[model samples]
Target: MLQRAFNKYIDNFRGFSREIWILTLITFINRAGTMVLPFLSKYLREDLDFSYNQVKWILISFGLGSIVGSWLGGKLSDKIGFYKIMIFSLMTSGIAFFGLQFVTSFEGLLVAMFFIMVVADMFRPAMFVSLGAYAKPENRTRALTLVRLAINLGFAAGPALGGLLIMTVGYKGLFWVDGATCILAILIFWIKVKEKKKSKYTDKEHPGEILTNSVFKDRPFWIFLGATLITGILFFQLFTTIPLYHKEQFNLSELQTGLLLTLNGVLIFFLEMPIVSYIERHKINKLKVITLGCLAMAISMYLLLVNQWAGILIIMMLFMTFGEMFVFPFSNSFAISRAPKGHEGRYMAIFTMSYSTAHILSAEAGMDMIRLFSYQNNWFFMGTLGIIGVLLFIWTMKLVKYEPPRNI
Candidate 1:
């Protein structure tokens, strides 16, 4: 009887699992390659024999490619089919990763990054669409959290592992690992995944451009976009100026710096669901929750500007993380619920682009702040931007006529 009960439990678990596990595994492999990302700027300058201007151009080209790919990916998914588009894009991304092995010059690197990012970005938008499609609305947040959990686990391991590989096997060997994993992800997904076709609800949206094209004309999306632009300005500063602050101001070792970031990811991974539960139970409104999260992120980044030891910074990060947990998942869930039915792909694409655009523009501005005044000014500038974001979210609540956001 106990054995029979165990078999029944196993069957029930499988029934509930869905294909999310496969998707998570694929996403894990992709993000794991990101371990090499932190060191890339240095490599571009030192090993590739590129001028500073050339390296800047390469990064710009990569961002531009993602912009292009995001738009195209949404379009293709709308027209062709999400699964087919995803599979092909994932395979191409694996090829692009392999291409990294040969690139030796600025021009070669630019071309390689262009293709790599284009394919990678394509997969992300498709993944968003897939998540939106497959998960029941009530379970969506939990489902997406699992995806984040898997990716973070990969991200957590990637940097430490990449650092090891770079020292022992050299940089090229790390690139090999990146390529091989992408291929492995593709193979695993191709054999195991099953996709649900969108019914007539999708058919109406297609040639969806007629409806989607004019979607910009609506003032609500514009207001949300404005709010998002400011929010992006605040959160995106971490990638650009935060590391320099650690090194120049705090004098942290490279490993210490990497672990700080890993901690942020780890906090987000372990605490998100509990944090989500806490935020939901709080009597505060959704807008308030989002504002608080943005504030926490902004303040923490600002704290780095101050003279502090490692312990202080880590503590501030923990405080900021509490807010981040509430903001990202809840904000995304609220936004998708507000989207016009069947337009999830387009809505998410625009939102994701906010982050991409912020990263590119902030890099130069962030470096300039550190150069002219100090790295502290980088946080000062971004924190002010975040304050403005908080007000914009408040104003959006007053201005937009949509139904109130359902959850905190």
Candidate 2:
């Protein structure tokens, strides 16, 4: 039975093109190597002795940079092709990571962080657009899940390794590793994945197309983006506010917090593909799945209200992990599907921008709430925001027509 189950798990990964696997490998290498983000808040607060307000602003700068990067990546991918954009973004960002360790002053760090993120996040939309060229439409959702699985696998390894690096060599070590990995990942991709010529979209390629309207004028998609922004805010708290809370509330060490985060990555790595495959097989409505994910995240926040037990942290991570598993893959597939043929980069860029915007708000808002009110109150606020996201998703469902996945 165990062997059969393992075989079934392996079977879920079948049918992807060789390029998809290579992309997944590149993502893993990059994400695993770029481990600074999960610990950036902690490094700023404890290592540099930055004030909470200073940390918040630095994080906001990071987000603002991400917004610009996403927009640029998408637009440039449409113009110059995703191949060149991916190479440039990763190579430049990798070099920047090496220089970042020297900038310790609050003002200097803010500027440094912003520029680094601007370069780094440009990889996101380019990567998304590349998937459109690489994966078959019928298997797009599964392919996305496969890439996400790689990301989670990298996350699972990165935090634990980052904790050890911090203990032995201090935070400086993270920069060198992150920089090296970005270059390494991109080099591998440059060698292995030959760029394909862009394909033109036609009526037969996408029948009954709803994304025929201008992207700015797509009301349902805008509402969906709003919901995505809210959920992204809720999700990003895992990296920002939640880590601080782990230390302050439970007196967990950096290693302990890293392990807790590793659990989130581990769960997603093992379970997410199967879950996504199951949903696809059942022909589930993507919006409904997204709404369910929103509710799960809200409950995870509310679970944090039980501050007495450290075990509750584990429970909270489980809910948050499952929520992420449900939301992100479907979200990617949905966003890509909504794009008009030639404008994939533009559509994906806007979709990715929602998360970048969320990152800015998540850190600033979370810190403000913690400063003004109690942690419990902050949790209450996040939970309420998640509920609002759920409602918005439901409203979006009413506004947009759902297209079942095509066999072609």
Candidate 3:
């Protein structure tokens, strides 16, 4: 029985193109190098001696950079093609990692973080555009699931390695290793991936003409974006608030905290692809899947109220992981299904920007709540936000008439 189940899991990997596999490999390599961001809050609080407010501001800077980068990535992908934007983003951001080691002052560090995120985040929109271009319409969502599997697998490795690096050679080593990994991803991509040939469905407009297609002018998209931002605020707390909660509430060491997060990645790596495959095979409604995810996320936040209990913490992470598995990849599919021809980049960027915006709201608001009230209160607030997200998601779909775009 287990053998057949494992074979079914392997079946999901079949039928993808060479480019899709290459992109998945690139995603894995890039995500594996993502060592710095997960531990940035801890580094700021412990090593740099940042006040809660200062940490908040620094995170806001990172979010601001994400906003700029995600938008720019889309615009550039539409204008110059995904290739140039990706190569430039990867190479430049890799170099910036080395620079982060030298910045000490709060203002300087904030600026450094902003620049790193701006460069690093350019990969997202470009990557999605590439995914859309490479995968057949029917396989697009599954392809995305595969990419995310690569990401979660890499994430499962990165933090554990980061924990070891921190103990052996400090945060500076994290910077160096992460920088090298980005460069390595770039090398693999340059060698293995080629620009996809234009297909029958490809928009034939001039790149400049295509650039005129705008997401800001779409009302339904805004409703969707609003729902996305609400969910994102709660989802992003995994990176921002949860780490601090573990450190302060339980005095968990860096290794222990990294392991907690690793549990999230490990579960997703094992479960998400299979679950998505089953959903697709079973013809489940995407919106229903997403709503269930939002409710689960809200419940997870509430579970955090049972702080200092290791078993409860693990259970909370489990709920959060399952919620993310349901919410995030389907959200990508939802946006992609709605994208009009000649405007895929802009539509994707807007959706991506919702999470970027959440990073800003999540960090500043979350940290401030922890500082002013208690962490328990912060969890309650996050739970409330998640509940609001579930309502908004349901309403947003109804308001938009909920049709997938007819074209791939």
Candidate 4:
């Protein structure tokens, strides 16, 4: 029975095409090279000697660029194609990283950060559209989870490696390595991942047929997007406010912070795929899964209310990691499944916007909130946001129905 269960677990990873795996590999390579954003807050504060407000504004600029990039990527993916966009984003963003190494002044850093993020973020919607194009409906969630698995696995490596690199090569060296990895991922994607011509969505009409329906017209999706943005604002603190909290409240070093943050990726790397597979095979209600995930997130923040110790932080991260494992991949699959045929890029882009927008708000608002209020208050606010996220998902679930995979 144990062997059988193990085999079943292995089977979850089977059935995806070589292209899908290549796409997953591309995500992994890119994510593994993601050494910048996680450390940007710290770099701004300590290395660049910026104030709290300056750091917030710099990050906000990056967020604004992300918002633009997400929109443009989706629009351009539909018009041009995902492959071209992916290649361009990878190569140009790599160049941008190299360019960022030269910037010295605050204004220069902000401008460079904004452009780099803009180019880098263009990958999101295109990647989602390609995943939908490549995978069967029944395997969609697992496939998405597999990609996230690769991302988390890379994330597990990126920060820990980044911490080490900080001591060895400093921030500029980090950018150099990051740029090289993006270039490498681009090569793999260009050579290995082929474009597909088959219909990915349920519309029987031609690709041009559904182009008339804009994502703005999709009321249910907007409702879903709103909910996503709410959770996003709270969830993104993993990068911004949380790190600052560790620095100020706990007085932990960069290496220590990276390790603690790495705990999140470690949990996701080990558990996300199996759990998502189990939930998918068992035909569990996605709504229930999401609701539970949000509640878990809420509880994690509330747990932070009591202590500032490493033990409590780890416990809080455990709950948060579980919540992330449950929510993110399933949500991506949900967006893919709901996309209106040709409008997949737009639909997915709008969903991507939630995070991009959250990136905007989380830095500016979250930092300000922590400054004016306190870390304890921020935790309370995040907990409240999570509860609101739960209510939103419960409500949105009623408005939207999951369309099963169409065998093209």
Candidate 5:
């Protein structure tokens, strides 16, 4: 079944193009290298002997670096082009991973983490901007869907293989693998990807004309940003809170937790294309799917707070997964519709920044609560947040004009 789907994805050249495939391939390779990150706190806490607070700082440092990287990458992508920007991002990110091999202190680890986030996030603005350039409105959702599936495919293999690598290669081994893939991805991009003359969007304005507020003045862009900012905040549970909950409350092994997270990726892989296609066929507004995403998360998370049983907790994961499937790709497609002339990279980068900012917010609010109350309480808090997110999503739909066709 999986093989057939893989072949179909390869053959379905309309939804995903050659550029999408190569870009996703590079993403897959790089993601496969860092699959060990799910295990990072374990290594930090158990091996390097860092505290929860120190690890929190690590997350924050990465978040901070990602903010700068995202802004710079988008800005640079606009100034130069996707090809040069992406190649540099890939290598810089890889070198940062390689640097992780030698880190002995918390400060060193934080620095490495920061740069890694910077470069990885930077590559994305370039890549997604490239994608936005290549695709049109009608097939855009499916295109983004395919890219996401490729990423999840990489993630599915990354953690499991990373576990094996850890057994044989140690913690530093993962970084080396990531670094190597970064180099390889860069080479592939240099050879296979070609930058064309700037698209209509890119060439609309003169160079250095980015700060013109007319682009930012789009009411739809502001609405979607608010929608995305809230969505990003709610999505934070997957990384920041879930692991802590598993350990502090459920007492699950690290292996079990890893598998659970992997399961989330699996859900995305199997369902993303079908869901996007179905919604597109129904002519359903993308905002509707995004709203359901928030609802799914809210229900599932609320269930987690209500149920004490581990089995139910696992089942509840499906809710969040289903919610995510609806919300993420659809919102991305929706956001792309809001971009103004010549600013696709900057717009998408703003969307990316929303998530980076959300993680920092989630960790800050969530960790303080965990420090005071229990993980169960944190679940309830997140559940509440999800509910609020759904309201925001509904409000977003009312405001944003998902009604119009994209600018061809």
Candidate 6:
């Protein structure tokens, strides 16, 4: 039975194109190199001695840059191609990371962080559009899961490695390594993946069928974006408020905190693809799965309310990891599927922007709540937000069911 299960796990990873695998590899390299983010808040608070209010503004700036980057990346990908945008985003952003270590003042770091993020996050929507070009319709969801697995794998390694770097060489080393990896990942992609014009292969799997409806007019999609925004806000706490809580509440070292986050990455890495595969094979409703994810996230936050034991941290991470697994892959597939043949970049840009917006709100709101009330109150607020997301998703499902089919 163990052997049979192992074989099934292996089978789930099969059938992706070589290009898809290469893309996954590139994503892994880039994500693994991103050691700066999980530790950014801590660096600002402890190393740079920034006030909580100042740190909040800096992170908000990061989110603002991400928002603009997502919009520009999607728009330019549609105009020039995802290939050019991907290359430029990575290459320029990598160079920017190197300069970031030099910016210590609050105002300098704020502007610098915003500028770097603007370039760095442009890679997101472009990469999504590229998948639509490369993967078959039947395989798109699995392909998305594969890329997510790479990201989780990278997350698993980045933190543990980042912890060691901080202890030995300090945070400055992180900037250098992150910069190098960005350049290296893009170089590998440049060498291996030739640019393919979208006109050649887009929508060929279903000839004469294109979703031409304006995304702004899609009521279900707007409702769905609301759900997405809520979940994004809930989930982003892992990076923003959660780390500070680990130190303040539990007295865990950076390495210890990283290990807890590593657990999240490890769980998602091993279990997410299988879960996504099961959902795809069973033809489950994507929104229903997303709702379940929101519920899981709510439970995760509530688990944090039990702050008596360090063990609760592990349990909380588990629930949050499962929530992430349930929400993100299906969300990607749903958003991409909603796009008209040529307008994928636009739709995906908006989808990614919701997360950027969430990042802004999650950081400032979480910090503000912690300052005024308590960490416990912040957790309670985030848990309630997740429950709200669940209701929004259910409403989205009803809207989608009654909605007339779009022209193909």
Question: Where is model 6 poorest over a 10-residue stretch in terms of lDDT?
Answer: 204-213
Clashing pairs in 4: none
lDDT of candidate 1 over 121-216, digit per residue (tens): 877667877877777665566566667777778878887788898889877777778877877887887789787686456547354554455357
Residue by residue across 333-382, what tens digits does model 3's lDDT show?
Answer: 88876765546777787788888888788877898899899899999999
Identify the runs in model 3 with alpha carbons over 4 angstroms from their true place.
Answer: 41-55, 104-107, 197-214, 246-259, 305-310, 400-408
Model 1, residue 17: distance off in Å is: 3.8
The lDDT per prediction is: 0.70, 0.87, 0.83, 0.80, 0.76, 0.89
RMSD of each: 4.6, 3.4, 2.9, 3.2, 3.1, 3.5
The numbered model that scores best in lDDT is 6
Positional deviation of residue 312's Cα in model 6 after best superposition, in angstroms:
4.0
**How do the predictions measure up, each by TM-score?**
0.87, 0.90, 0.89, 0.89, 0.88, 0.90
So what's the TM-score on candidate 1?
Answer: 0.87
In candidate 2 the C-alpha lDDT for residue 186 amounts to 95
Determine which window of 10 residues in candidate 1 has minimal summed lDDT.
8-17
The residue-level lDDT of candidate 5 at 207 comes to 40
Scored against the true structure, residue 61 in model 1 reaches a CA lDDT of 86
Which runs in model 2 stand beyond 4 Å of their true positions? 42-53, 102-107, 167-170, 202-212, 247-256, 309-311, 402-408
- So what's the TM-score on candidate 4? 0.89
- Candidate 6 lDDT tens digits, 324-404: 999999888888878876778888999999998998888879988999999999999999999999999999889877866
Query: Candidate 2, 29: how far from true, in Å?
Result: 0.8
lDDT preference between candidates 2 and 6, better one: 6
Pick the winner on lDDT between candidates 3 and 6: 6
How many backbone overlaps does candidate 6 show?
0
